[model samples]
Target: MCGIVAATAQRDVAPLLIAGLKALEYRGYDSAGLAVLQEGEIRRVREKGKVREMESQYLADPFPGGTGIAHTRWATHGVPNKVNAHPHIAGHVALVHNGIIENYASLRSELESRGHAFTSETDTEVMAALIGERLASGKSLLDAVSSVVHELEGAYAIAVISDKEPGRVIGARRGAPLLVGVGIGENFLGSDAQALIQVTNRMIYLEEHDVVEITRDRVRIFGQHGEAVERTIHESELSTDAVERGEYRHYMQKEIFEQPRAVADTLEARIGPHGVLPNIFGVNGDELLGKTKGLHIIACGTSYHAGLVAKYWIEDYARLPVNVEVASEYRYREAVVPDGTLFVAISQSGETADTLAAMRESRRRGYLGTLAICNVPESSVVREADLKLMTRAGPEIGVASTKAFTTQLAALGLLALQLARHRGLDDARYADLTAQLQSLPKKIEKALELEPQIVDLAEHLIHRQHALFLGRGAQYPVAMEGALKLKEISYIHAEAYAAGELKHGPLALVDEDMPVIAVAPNGPLLDKLKSNLQEVRARGGELLVFADGAASMDGNAARGSILRIDGGGDFIAPAVFTVPMQLLAYHVAVLRGTDVDQPRNLAKSVTVE
Candidate 1:
């Protein structure tokens, strides 16, 4: 993922660009840079680190200007360094771009033949050179960007500024997200609204292949057909408090603790004295599911894990055949697309490249309709989907997701209930499930109370080099999520297996030094899970069990470490059980002194495939 911000304002725009990049820092990047048009030239600064390093340089020697573009780069086509950072300059044009140029190889060869010299080994620089070449042909900045965009391929959200085109910035988007920030005596462009919310909340979300030209007092948008277009400017409701860590150590910790309110917010207004509300989903629920014969869930990373949990819920309740596939792999394979299958894509940030591409591929293969279960309201996936279910998790700043995952499950749970009700679920069952859904926020709060206990348990497993997680039925996906959290932040080698799969292979890795954590919720598989714990103990594995308070386990030498937390219920247990696991990973990473919020080699959003 990368971030881009551009501003043309009445006063100093370099500071605003810097602040905007700082806001977008949670998106993740290895290097940062900015280009400002001043005195008939584009002045630039690039640094190979977080935005703080660039800010320090700015403070020491400020790049003062009223029009500029900034970028935080997550390397894709080349090594991350000052040369490979963004705000790439060519001739008189300076540009910052997010997303890849798949045709860069051919374009670079053509440009080289045309005598355009390259400096950095980045696809972004190639676009800068192309745009600069177009400008060199005596074309205006707006026309040059419009003409060049028609010749480019793959996903890109780019902002360009040039000394030749003073007092203006040009932006274009296709596949990736770009928005124009409306401000008095100033107009801005950013990869997301969060970066510009402090400056102005009014935003214009550019549609795919739309080019925008912004000046101090004017903003014009052009469609791919070279026709002028008007995009609505909506006010963002996100406040500054959502992005701050008021009392928590890191955003991850803040997000983990905020799950109660987040889940509550997601459930608000959708449930009442009546059963699950109709049309809670953006589309008509009954009409959509009535024609849907099967379901396919596509996602990546934590969102994929959320889909895995929903598989159990939807199949058991809705009685529809469900297939969950990793979006990165699903798009590449020549997979089967059943007739009348409802395609659902899940992502916290709807800009996830693989999931978005998979959604497009599903449409090409002619699925009944596409649904996007995402957190952002105006994200690419939401805009493209036939139906949209907004996960009200707010802004998840942590690279390793916490509240986003739970809120997605909450949304998917609502979707499942909608399908089940359409399939003729009895009133008693519906009321019971609805009541449980209403109480979910309180149950999540109760789970959050176990953090101190989880932190204490973390002390036992902090020294672990390897760990094993086990669960049965619906809890199996929960086990996978726990393992993912452990490995993602703490750098511990962890694996999850269905309790029955222990004897199949993973049991051989069990030993006293390795910790085996089991999610043993009270259910039909409780007995089976207890036996799996026994197997681990017999193999000399140090065992930690997160079990229901009433679910008794005989404490032996290795079984003494039991984390007693309630499983809210069978339906909502996955969301409840996720809290302790998150706390464990957070505490272990804290003990290990790892970056709990920005973990190594990972970006908060994968905007590029």
Candidate 2:
């Protein structure tokens, strides 16, 4: 949830550190600060806003030194205030940290007993304080840091600088990302590749519980015990457009509209003119279920919703039994993954902490080789998986993901069809499905024509306090995600249910003031969903219908208005479905004066658990 960039070099390093922080601005931050060790002491500057705010402060009184650590924090332990910002300092050690320390309270209590007065609410402050306390006992800097390692709890990628060791920056990672940039007589350490992408793409991904000691001329990697380990540097090829948001009000809106193009782009690159699908991986699909057999899908948030959409495609087309599990919870259960088990991991970043951890757990038990469907090519998930597909989504900057999620559905839907063909499905039906897949973009464009009215509908519901989205069968997951989007950015109270389940419980929440949004596509379930809408109408509930062309409305229906979308084919529904829901959330948030790009209490990348 925070950004960290540090450089320990033989030459001046302040300019490079600032550039790296600018590159990581898209990850999100609330405050910015930097610390440098120079002239036998540590100098620091921190501010409560953007990096620019810190920059202005630094210009007045810069922390000039060869070795330094910086942070762009998204406040968790304290409010976004100057005193709460990072680059917390001790007597001789200055440190910056990412991720939370679960046991900081107990640590703080112990430090307080030792006469270490706390100044900030941040768990990071405890790190510096602990190191200071240990150093007061006359321990070496390395020993002081190493001693605190055994006492700290929770995930962190941390960097420390000491006046006594002015030429080096000692760093370590337990869960969050940390990289070492190799340069002649200079070394770089950062939380993300983007932070160091401009300076040098050549770097090594630090492993779990690894301590990295960086100096002006050398970078040493060590195990938690200080045992030496050799690491290789891999080059990064990041495109300029990967970070720029061209000609859009916000990244969320741009990503929402990028869906059709992103889907089309993934198809052009992965699928051949001959209709053969990408690799299905050789792992036994049944093995993932503990020999009971079937595919086990793991993902988090938006990607998990995409997995749910793919659930329909796999079951309907391939006749394969499939189960979708949230990656964060997948490992906790004794899921008996059968032999030949196919584990499908869906992620946009492909670096989602929980999902990546789950994928590693699956590999540990000898499940079938995993398949990764992700947008980023060199991402951790893609690198670890046996087979992978890149969604070619360029870059999705919105905290509430739009393009990446849709493109994932498109790619996974194609994966499902590919598996069906491999399993000896009928050629004619496959051909029809292929045609539908190819025709999805045009239908998505037709759906975009309804956007202006969607903006209007969102404006209508903007002031309403609560909402419900309902769908049946394949569209059930679509309903779930639509509700998620509304609640994510707008801070609205929203929930989703199968249209058929209204009578069970969700119906009780419907009233004149509460609006119900229905995902009624032109299919067998359309009439069933329509009947549910009428049921809501009976209770005086306001209904906003997002429907296919076939969902007819009588002249002047009193309870709701029907917004028609071109539902050309069966497979096209889910691909084109999320467009309206995205715009609805976008417009509603716009009307409510909310920041659509970065919502409250959220970060674009969930790098820390």
Candidate 3:
């Protein structure tokens, strides 16, 4: 994933571009750069690190211009360095791009044969060179970009600025995301709405193969066949404060603490005093979910783990068979989709490339329909799906997701309730489940209270090179999520396994040097999990358990430490248990002097396959 921000404004646009890049920093970038058309010349500034570094350079030596393009790059084609950073330039053309150019090597060869020289190892540079060549052949900037896109193969959202075409920027998207922000006297381009939200609340989400050209006060869009097209302008509901890390050291920390309110926001109006309301998904949600015989849930990374938890919830509560597939694998294989099986895609960004591809492929696999569970209302997955459910987690800026995961669980829990109703679940049990779902925010709040204990536990874990997370039944997914958080942020090598599988192979990795963390909720499997913990104790494995408040830790404290969570019921424990896992990872990452918000080699949204 990368970030792109471009603007054609009446005033100096350098500051706006920098600010937009800062807002999009969470998408994960190793380097930053910007190119501005100043005095009919393209001026460029690039940095090998954070956007703040480029901002500092801009503050010292300003690159003032009325039109500019900026980028924060997550390296794919080259090493992360100033030379390889974005704003790759060729002649008068300067550009920033997101996503891969599948046929860049051949394009590079062709360009070289035409006497074009290259400087950087980035495919973006090849694209810039190709556009420059087209311009040299007397093509307009828009024509250059639009025509070159036809020759390109693979996903990309690109913005180009030329010194010859001052006060204007050309942008195009195919298989990747790009949008336009409409302002009073300015227009903008960004990878997503957040990049331009600070400057404009009005946005136009571009569709596939749409090319747009923006000047100071005009925006023109073209369809795939070069025909003029119009797209609806949506007013963004996001405020600047939603992306700020208020009172918290990092975005991850703030998002972790915001889980309670986030879940409440997701559940707002969708639930009533009696149970989850019908048609919360959409007008036809009841009819589609009612006829569903089976489900195929597809996702990646943290969202994949959330789907795993949902498999447990839907099967246990709704009495339906569910299969959770990693979107990357499912997209490339021929899957056995039974009749009446609904395909559900889960994603925080809703633009995760693999998951979106999998959802598109499902349309040809004889599935009943597609349902999108996502946070972004205008994301591609939501726009394409037949049914939609918004997670309402707001903007999750942290590369390692916190609020998004919990809100997804809450939303999926409601889905389970809806399906259970169709299965003739008793009225009294439905009310009880609804009551527990309503009270989940308080349980999450109680779990957040365990941060101090988790902070203390981080001291013992920061120096450890490896860890093991254990859980049973539904909590197994919770354990997997915990391990993912630890490794993602703290760089600790962590793994998770079902507690009953200790005797298989994971047990051999446990020893005094490895810390074994378990989510021990007081449930049907509590005693069995305790037995598994004893196996760890026998091998002198250091134990750190996140246990229920009522669960006994009689002998556990003798050899280990216990952090208690006031888990009100087993039905909501997954969301509650998620808190300490996030807190521990945050604290450990802080202690290890790692990037808590943007972990190395990881991006917030996996937009590239």
Candidate 4:
């Protein structure tokens, strides 16, 4: 992921650029830079650290200009450092970009033959140099940008500035987020809504091939052939407070408590007035439901865990064979998908690198249809899919991901229910499952009340060099997600193993110092899960369990520790149990004194491979 910001006004705009960069820091924090127009020349300031470091360097000299662009990069082509940062320039042509350039290798070789030299090791530098070459050869800024974009072969949203056209800027997008914000006497361009949210709520979101010309007092958008196009502007519904951490020490903790409302928003549109699951798409879904022979779910990281739970629900309810693949590794293995295969991709940011690549590969292989369940509307994944469902988790600022995971479960659970009905499996059994889905909001709210005990456990949190996550059935995925959260922010070496697999290899890692968090909810796998828990105890590993009160906790009652999410059945308990695990991870990271929101070496989106 990368963050981009630009401002064009009659007065100096470097201050706005700095503020915008801070707002978008959640997306990326590796290296940041800013470029401004000088007296008929281009001036730039950059550093290989957080936004704060770059801002401190800029405040000394302070390049004064009425127009500028800035970027914070997550880095894909090269390592994260000042020499590899964005805002790459060749003379007057400056470019700040987010997303990958797939054909950069071929282009770089061609540019070298033309007696042009490069400085930074980034694909974006090649793009900037290409534009500079075109502009030097008696071409206008608009034509130069359009010409270079035609030669590029992958996704990018680029904002270009030229000293020759002292008061203007040009922006273009193909497969990533780009927006233009309208202000009183200025205009803004950003890779995220937060970058321009404070300056102006009114924004025009760009689509593929849409090129925008920004000036001091006017913005003009056009198509490929210079045909003027009208832009659609909408008011942002998210409260600025939604992105703020109210009363909580961190945004992750606040988002953990917002799960009940988030899940409710996900279910609101799907539930009909008569308490029936309404059709998502008016006509496209029939083709999906009637012709689907089997289902394939693909994703990366936390979204992959959501797919893991979906595999169980789709098979148990609809009797359809389901295979879950990690998006990064999905297409590398040549696996056969039957005819009428429905490939489903799950992503929260929607710009995930491997997930988007896997979805593109699945489409080329003649899958019946591709579907995506994500949180951001109008994302690349949503535009590519045959069907789309947006998770209403609002803005998830935390890089560790709390509310997004819970909402993914809600949306996928609805999909499973709709699939079961189409397969003629929606009898009393199906209705019972829907009732449990309806009760999920309540169960999640009750689970949020367990924060006190979780915090108490956080105080006694084991600073283990290594740890283990144990579970079975649907809870197995829940355990994986727990371990992922713990490792992502806390930096503990945590691993998730199917509890049954404990005796195989991981049993060797268990010791008195290794704490095992067992996600053993009430289910058909309860007895087997508990037996696996005892196996860890026999090896001197400390046991911490999340059990169901309705189920028989007879033996586990006398065990090491209990944090009960007690209630609910196999169909909906996973979502309920997920809340407590999120809280536990948040508390543990706090105890460890780590950055909870912007975790080290991670970004909100994965725009490049």
Candidate 5:
């Protein structure tokens, strides 16, 4: 995902644009650039690395202006380099963009035929060229952008500045997210609220295919059909302190430690003295649950793993058959839609392109209704969902998810209990499950106490090139998520398999260099999992086991090491066991000198397919 921040102010806004890019650094980017209408001309500066490098260049020689647009580019159409950075200019137009242009190749060819020379191999430059072509035809900046966007066939959020217009920034969004920050004596445009939090908090989230025009004194919006429109301005809930990495080495580590509070927040008010509240999901959630015969869970990345865990919970507790599918594949293939099945989509930042598209496509496939379990309330998935369960994991800034994943489990746990009520779950059993959830925050705190042990355990993984994770039953998804964390942040090749599947094919790859990690909570599968560990031990694979305190691995001390997590039992152990996995990844990535928060080539919010 790329980040965009633009401003039309009464004063010079170079510093403001740079600060906005710095705030959006967590989104992940490979290059940074800015363009300002200064000194009666459009001046542009771009660098191939971090925003700090571009900031340093701006400090040495500033491009002070009353109107400007800035971007942190995550390479998509081309490689990450100065020549491929954003703020690509042609004629009088300077533009920065996020999202892919599906018809860029054809448009580039047509633009070239019109005597337009392209400088960079980017779809965004094609946008600038097309808009610049319109500007040459005596069209206004707003008209030029609006006309050019009609020809582009894919998702994009673009901000444009024309030297012809002194104090104006025109922006538009199709499938990607874009917002306008309302400020006195200034108006701003950004990819999200975080990019403009330093200047203004009140924002207008643009609808799909909406175009906006901003100046220091006025704001105008056009609907998809070129008709004038109005949008509500809401105050952003994000605070500056929420994004700061205070008392932690990286955002990933801070998010890992914030799971207790995040889980508590997601569970708050949903659980009561008796059991989970019926209205926790929405006003009509209880009715929806009553009619739901099955569930189709759809998501991507960590959220997809979350759906895999929910499949086990709903089937066991609610007695409902469930099907979980990756959103990217779900949308492309022919799927049988079971009648009375509720479609559920999970995403941390609900802007994930594949998941959002799948949710939209579900409308035509005859699902009962759509439910969104997400963190951001303003996101597209939440806005479009028929019902919503918000995971109150405030502002997850890490590229690799931690608190968001746990909060998702907390939300899904509530969903399971609610559905169980409709299936004749007894009061006593409901009370037991509620009590387990109520005490989960305290249990998560106890799990955090194992960080020092996990830090010590991480020393064994720092030099290793590969790792294997094992779990049975619901913990299999936890194992999958743990392996994803290690590979994402540490650059270690990792794989996860059901403990029972070890003898199938994966056991052949086990050796002294391949470390095997297992999630062993005291459950029916504990003994079976131990047998699988014995198989690994026989092959000389080092064991790094995260076991419950009661599930003892008495004789395996010399194989590798064991970190016992405290107070983990049925239903909640998956969430509790996830803590050590997160901590282990954090410490190993730190020890290996990797970018733990913003890993290479990975964007936090995937806005492009």
Candidate 6:
């Protein structure tokens, strides 16, 4: 994923462009660059590092202009360097792009044969050169962009500026996310709404194959066939404070702490005086649940782990068989869609490439209905799905995804309750579940109080070369999520298995050198989980246990380290236990001196397959 922002305004746009790029830094941060129209020519500035480095270099030797485009790159094509950064310029045209160009190699060869000299190693530069060549032959900016998009193959959200058209910019999107910001005397384009919310809350999200021409006071949209198109402008509800780190050391930590409010916000509408409300899953929610005989969920990364947890809840409460599949793998293989199957796609940023493709592939296989549970209302998956549930976790700036994951679980919990009600759940059971869901925000608050203990535990694992996370039932997914968080941020080699399955193969590696982390909340499986811990202890494997306050630590007294966490309630323990694991990963990464927010080789969103 890369971040793209363009603005044409009456005042100098460098400051706004730079600020927007900073807001979108979580999407990509390998390199930063911008292109401004100055003195009737394109002035380009780029640097090989974070946006702060590029901003500092620009302030030292500034370029002034009222129209510009900027980018923060995750570096898909070439090594992360100035030559591979965005805001790539070719002749009079400058462009910034997100997503991949599959046909760039062929196009670059064709352009080079036609005597067009290439400078950068990025595919974005090839696209820019193609547009510049078309513009050089007398086509208008919009025409050149429109022509080039048809020739290109792959997902891309691109913004281009040409000196031939002094105050005009053109943007196009195929399969990646792109939005146009509406302002008083200016207009903007960016890959994310958070990047544009500070300047303009009103935004127009471009659909597949839509191209937009933006000027200082006007914006015109066109379809792939060059016909005029109309798109609605929606006002964003995100506040500026949501994107700022505030007093937190990093956005990851701030987001981890913000889970309480974020989960509360997600539950604000689903729960009421009686119980979980009806139609929380959009218009025909009750009817869809009634007709649904089975459920299938597709997602990637943290969202996939969220789906795995939901599989347990849905099958337990609604008495429906559930299947959870990785979105990327699900899209490639032939799917088995049974009769009356409800297909669900889960994604934090609705633009996840594999999830969107999987949703389409599932639709092609003829499911009864499709549902999208996502944070972004205007995302592609949301627009394509028949039913929608918005997580409302405002602007998760951290790449590690703290608030978004918990909020998705909150939404899924509401969905399970609603579906169970349709399956003839009694009012008392409904009320009990509702009460637990309503109490979750405060329970999560209590969980946050265990941060000091988690920090201490993290201190012991920072130097460990490898680790194992063990859980069972619902906690198995929790264990997988913990392992993912550890490896994602700390770069520690970590793996997870069901505690009962530890004796299968992983127990062989369980010695004092490799620490074993267990999820031991008080439940029916607690004794069995303890037995699994005993097995590890027998082998002298160093252990870290996250246990509930009610769970007895006497058995684990002489074995290894034990940290007590508020189990919240029976149904809500997963949400509560999730906090300490997040804190462990966050603190461990901090101690290891690794990039907690922007881990190497990972982007916030997977916009390319």
- Compared with the true structure, the alpha-carbon lDDT of candidate 4 equals 0.86
lDDT of 3 by residue, 1-609 (tens): 799999998899999999999999898989999999999999999999999998898788887989999999999999999999989999989999999999999999999998988999999999999999999999999999999999999899999999999999999998889999999899999998999999999999999999999998899999999999999999999999898888999999999999999999999999999898889989899999999999999999889899999899899888999999999999999999999899999999989999999999999999999999999999999999999999999999999999999999999999999999998888888888899999999988988888888888999998999999999998999999999999999999999999999989999988889889999999889999999999999999999998998998789755789888888787888888988999999999999999888889998988898
Clashes of each: 0, 19, 0, 1, 0, 0
State which candidate has the highest lDDT. Answer: 3
By TM-score, is 4 or 5 better? 5
lDDT string for model 6 (1-609, tens) is 789999999989999999999888887568999999997989888999889999998999898998999999987899999888889988889999998999999999999999988888889999999999998999998999999999999999999998888789899999899999999989999999988988999999999999999999999999989999999999988789777789999999999999999899999977887877788888988788789988999999999999999998888888888999999899889878899999999999999999998888886898989999999999999999999999988888778988899999999998888878878777787888788889999999999998888888888899998999999888899999999999999999999998998889999998888899999889899999989888998899888999999998676636578888887766788888888999999999999999898899899988998
Tens digits of per-residue lDDT for model 1, 1-609: 799999999898998999999999888899999988887778889999999998888788876889999999999989989999988999999999999999999999999998888999999989999889989999999999999988888999999999998999999999889999999999999998889998999999999899999999999999989899999999999888789889999999999988989998898888786567878776565688778888999999899989999999988888899999999999999878788899999999999999999998987888889999999998889989999888899999989999999999999988888888888787888877777777788988998898888888899878889999998988899999999999999999999999999999998998879889999888888888888888888888888898987687775336548877777678888888988999999999999999888888889889888
Instruction: List runs of model 2 lying over 4 Å from the truth.
Output: 9-19, 78-80, 105-115, 130-152, 182-186, 223-225, 278-292, 363-366, 550-558
lDDT of 2 by residue, 303-322 (tens): 99999989888888887788
TM-score of each: 0.98, 0.89, 0.99, 0.94, 0.99, 0.98
The global Cα lDDT (0 to 1) of model 2 is: 0.82
lDDT of 5 by residue, 471-536 (tens): 999999999999999999999999999999999999999999999999999888988999999999
Candidate 6: residue pairs that collide: none
Worst lDDT 10-window in candidate 2? 284-293
How many pairs in model 5 have backbone atoms within 3 A of each other, for residues 3 or more apart or on separate chains, i.e. clashes? 0
What C-alpha lDDT do the candidate models reach, one value each?
0.90, 0.82, 0.93, 0.86, 0.93, 0.90
Tell me each candidate's RMSD, in Å, in order: 1.3, 3.3, 1.1, 2.3, 0.9, 1.4
**Total clashes for model 4:** 1
